[model samples]
Target: MDEFSFCDKSLSYEVRVKDLIDRMTLDEKAGQIGDTALGVPRIGLPKYEWWSEALHGVSDVGQAGNHVTHFDDVIPGATSFPTVILTSATFNQSLWKKIGQAVSTEARAMYNLGHAGLTFWSPNINVVRDPRWGRALETPGEDPFVAGRYAVNYVRGLQDVEGSTEDDEVADLDSRPLKVSACCKHYAAYDVDNWLGVDRYHFDAIVTEQDMMETFQRPFEMCVKEGDVSSVMCSYNKINGIPACADPRLLKDTIRGEWNLRGYIVSDCDSIDVMLDAQKWLNDEPYYCLDLDCGYYYPNYANTSVRMGKVKEAELDSALKNLYNVLMRLGFFDGSPKYEKLGKSDICSHENIELATEAARQGIVLLKNANQTLPLKSNKIKTIAVVGPHANATSAMIGNYAGVPCRFTSPIDGFSKYGKVKYETGCGEVFCKNESLIFPAVRAAKKADATVLVVGLDLTVEAESLDRTDLLLPGYQQQLIQQVSSQSKGPVILVIMSAGGVDISFAKDDPNIQSIIWAGYPGEEGGHAIADIVFGKANPGGRLPLTWFYTNYTDMLPLTSMRLRPIESLDYPGRTYKFYDGPTVYPFGFGLSYTNFTYKLVSSTKTVNVKLNKFQHCRDLNYTEGSYKPPCPAILIEDLKSSCGDYKVKLEIEVKNVGERDGSDVVMVYWSPPQGIAEAPIVDLVGFERVFVGGGGGSVKVGFELDVCKSLGLVDFRGYRLLPSGGGKFVIGDGVLSLPLQINFRR
Candidate 1:
């Protein structure tokens, strides 16, 4: 009985979960619920490594001793947080529980170095309807309370919570085990309008019960009622005609009978053979009738003409005992378990190249700086050219699941190793090789004095198995940044770099482009962190996680109004910026910061009551400003502070940094759902707070509650549900809520 009694025979989940459900054999529980695989019987009981992908770090191949820092082998660095819509515009739950404890400390250091545990299907709480979904850079935008508070801090940072804490120590996360297993994706609604990936299996999408309980069941009802999430998957699109992984009214009456979700559902990744091949057969329309004299038909459609035991067997023994109860609570057949190893290393040091150069200087965004051109001061700029075709390229800042990267450096080797630099290849390597290098990068920005340029899109012109048919900029690199900003004499700057969002409305309304910087890919020390933000030695701040479109992929996708529109016409005022009202070439938590701040507006109220033990401070909100200010101000906060004492209904604010120097502000709050139950977007984000405002000013007081804004619906037009209402409204703009606050300086 030593190692947990060697699997107590009959395949133990403690004696085969109720004696193998009374001696199984319903086709071996419908072949353990299809999407199957087995193979490791060398010994017994401990070998179920079903392929993994934590969406950003933690992809395993039969484990290696912990050494996890790759980034060049393509996508494997962790904790770059913010994306999933800039970490849902920092509505900080202590920065998404320290980015879910740095993604369960790099997925328990990739399962203590031998791998196969941290399952991570990931924080793609899917909502970004159609900003040309090439997998909306793996979602978290087009709000549902900012994808349900980034799916409850990424499912409490890849499931390690049991009283977690690191750097501060305390971590008993169930005696230190779980270094992965945080699924939650697609499951319901899963949207993406075009460039046809054949609509996840013959498209169905019709949605509406108030846009399916307000925007696709609001982040799967905050990933199973406030992130108790363990696994959910199920999507390759099909909602109305039912598919989301054999939608048994969405994995059993709303993620296990109305959010009692105790974890384990899994399917996405060949979504249960696209739900047994979208129920056996020819969905007609072979490109709208190639008419052979009126009698259209094509039948067969492969997969042994379907009917592999037409489903059931208690729905494949409840999706194989909900994926073997998440491999028996991640002890995965007992091989010592408690995070077995940790942060493995094979070399790539200097603290994993300084955590991929501080995750490329925290996902650099600064969209437009305006007059100050930007940081550059290094003794008042002296002859630096740099130019584009992603400057020195080495796979333009390692985007997409990148890893094995260590030596990248480029913007012409980070500005010719520092001084009087000059390099061209302007826009040469569009996706592979164009090489005219924009007339020697506009003759080295016509004898430069100040010009950075760089330019983007190169995962061979947009990634995730390529799809971006438009969002411009390629080969010609926007006419070589309008011919090197018409041969700049000073201030040209552009930077760009892609993986998503690249239209750059002509260098954001160019005026010889004073500055633009987007940096989304920035990995292998993203060109020495874009030459330390062009020499001023770091400060850009980074924003815009996705949404910079302006008519590219067929004038912003129409695909017959997105397949005859309906998944609630893609909810939230109808998708991104609350139902695309046009004219946005930049918006979606847009970002930029050299320095500035101020948001004052607070309290609009749709709900607030609070007392959960004297509502934990955030300027103990009550409200007063009612004299004729409707430009979108909020800060309700009635009483939330529950540990179970009870007293809820909350919202609160105060951001103030009035700039001259120190910066950082996210503060967004959006809630609004009550009208006929949920068509949302006059308000959607529920709360967000991120601060740091020195230079003689500062403020912070944030809060939110109302069962943290509920929704969890539709587990059966294509299944999964939770449907309460009356929760929505919030805005914080002053850098990005709507962008106004200015933060007056003069210290």
Candidate 2:
């Protein structure tokens, strides 16, 4: 191996990476594919670790393993923000972008100060398919459209500086310098976690072609092309009979061939090992360590596979090129001028905290408010009872995989300044019951003007390794809630906190439970944010990210079943809001605002006819702009790649606040498929927007222009995406407005 023009700084990324690769020995090159890498110091390459965890803030995992350098100016710990579930509840894309920016800011600050690297595994955009999935707290909720939009907005913010020169904007994604690289992870239908007889780590998910393409893999496509996500991490499970980390159909055909991810592919920790050991899909050969320093066994088998005829060396080159390409964009070899300019003070700036607070304020859903019992009038409500395990809990506010906050606020702390606050330890554990003081909690509720019952699942019951057995709150929480609700003399506001949805049907039925707040692990400012909403300092606008399933949600399907669309043969129900027709405690995309908002469709749908012969090759609908072209097989093309953008339509709608109180609502746009299409879900979310209306009066009209060919329509079993030449109705604001759907794909 010989050194080349890798540090030249003036060459194209592709050219430089190719030149750099040309100089490496096969073994030296094999060392670079895993999470951590060995340095070719002779060639000036530093030992770089590709893995960094910045889910909600700059994490300590980014710190150097050897203490090679230190960041003195940056805060010791990054600011912990609300979990993605709570963040998605906001339904505000711009806010998501700011969060991405904040996280990137902290990440860059660490990297510049030698605390971290440039590639961050963050903004987990996986669509929460099942409420039982332990990592739902890490994802953006059940709806793929919302998740995709979040992916794009977050990537945009994470990748670029807000006030850069116009030249920066003009630079196409490929040619531009990245602030930091963002990863969209555990790609395609890797949602479920273990505990109940089925383990996702070794399960073979029988995902159908339609479910695989539409529901599971859709967000990754959006992240790749729209967000230009830097890398994709394969999952721990197997799709069909193939391990995700080794599936060429998924990693190569879909990601590289069709989706044009334009970045490296990473194996989830020891995922490749599971293929050889547990799944036994790969034949046992002597396992060689990919990185001696890292001691990973499976990546070497992948290396062996590449050296032998099983995996092509060209594929290895592609993966290597993608990884090197990202490093080049980050200017790692050139010494980052961008990184140097960033300081430790950027870790948890005031602006970051402010944005997070606003996000928490908006994302905390007001699930129920009967007879307007909320926004307690301070003069009328002199005494407030805040009681529960979560009332004064710090960990309850910050969910899993978060940075340590400078200080955390609890519900009791949040409500203290609002009234004469009285707090009683109602329960000891979020999941277990140590409710010996249940009588005292009831007494406190009966004595106060209003009772804020803070109760819900925490990390112990709902995080990575702990998928709950039932939707009901664990232990005696339900019993405790009912006991306190029955005794409360005044309005009872049930505040449930969890990353995943919980069944609070009992509280919903109780007339004494006048209001319910879904404050799913609202981070550092959770207390203040909750206080703000209760005091009317901030209107509660956040909505449910995932459905609050009925207690029998477990009975609907097996935890290991990968199907998102139903199988009539087995009486299988679907996974998400789109396919699941089962009863829900609270529907996906459902939320309550203090003020009522009315929606009206103002624009008419138009029909467009395209001659099939003129457009024979259709771009894969969910794939990138000009990629994924085998063309619609039935059609012939005169101009093969010139005009695929001709299949879009626009719809406009007006929204108004009808209530006397001011509030905001997230207007969701959905598409109901033509009946009898077994592949289609009952309704799929297509688009959404957050709108604000004034107290008693205010209106705003919004328009959505959808690519009929790209976002919606029909496809063959091959996952070759193409719009149904015949169009269908696009529903706006749930069912408030519906328009005609008409598209003619004529041959």
Best by TM-score: 2
Candidate 2: tens digits of C-alpha lDDT, residues 623-732: 32443222332222224235557756788888888888888889888887544344556787777889887877688998888866555655445665555434467777
Per-residue lDDT for 368-414 in model 1, tens only?
87876677777776778887777777644655544334366767777
> How does residue 271 of candidate 2 score in lDDT?
64
Q: Candidate 2, residue 251: CA error in Å? A: 0.9
Best by lDDT: 2
The local distance difference test score of each candidate is 0.54, 0.75
Q: Pull out the clashing pairs in model 2.
A: 74-344, 617-631, 618-631
Tell me how far the alpha carbon of residue 139 in candidate 2 is from the true structure, in angstroms, after superposition: 0.6
Which ten-residue region of model 2 has the weakest summed lDDT?
286-295
